[model samples]
Target: MYLIAIAWMYVVVMMTIAEAASPGGTLLGAFFTLVLYGLLPLSILLYILGTPARKRRIKARQAQEAPAEGHPPSGTSSGVAPDARSQPPAAAQTDSVSPVREES
Candidate 1:
């Protein structure tokens, strides 16, 4: 993906140079060609194409920072530690705000 972007930028740079060297082409035209034809579209394309990679990087970093199974991070859990508890909480002792209904 990056290789493609680099190749494209190289092409655009050459095109910009050709534009600047042309008899009728102005420096302003070259600058506009570089920016409008090269930088803008390439930036948007790379960002869109790199979405999955960015997401993967984020997930990988989070996974590395995440605590191991059965071991919660410090100061994040409320009350007693999950491993320290010997029994489950009562069914009625839920934190749900919605009322339960019985089936007919």
Candidate 2:
């Protein structure tokens, strides 16, 4: 995946450089060439090639989750009860810290 992305970038950079070096080629023209000829096709190719991998990952995740779906989640690994996890501590419940300081 990374290799494809890197290779695409290299090709695009080289193409941009070539376009910039061509007779009567402006930097703006090079930019447009890079976008049109390099990035557009590369992006489309990556998306098409990546579809199956993405689908497989999603399917694997769903399969792993299916078994655990029927069971209720247990308490935290640290042994904190469900009740403690549901509520904030007493200090956090009140706005004890004032933003403005009174002049002495």
On a 0 to 1 TM-score scale, where does candidate 1 land against the true structure? 0.64
Query: For model 2, how does the per-residue alpha-carbon lDDT over 22-95 read when each residue is reduced to its tens digit?
Result: 99888998999888877888889889998999999997887778557753334333233335557644544666
* Model 2 poorest ten-residue lDDT run: 71-80
TM-score of each: 0.64, 0.56
Q: List residue ranges in candidate 2 displaced over 4 A.
A: 1-9, 71-104
Tell me, by TM-score, which candidate is best: 1
lDDT of 2: 0.76
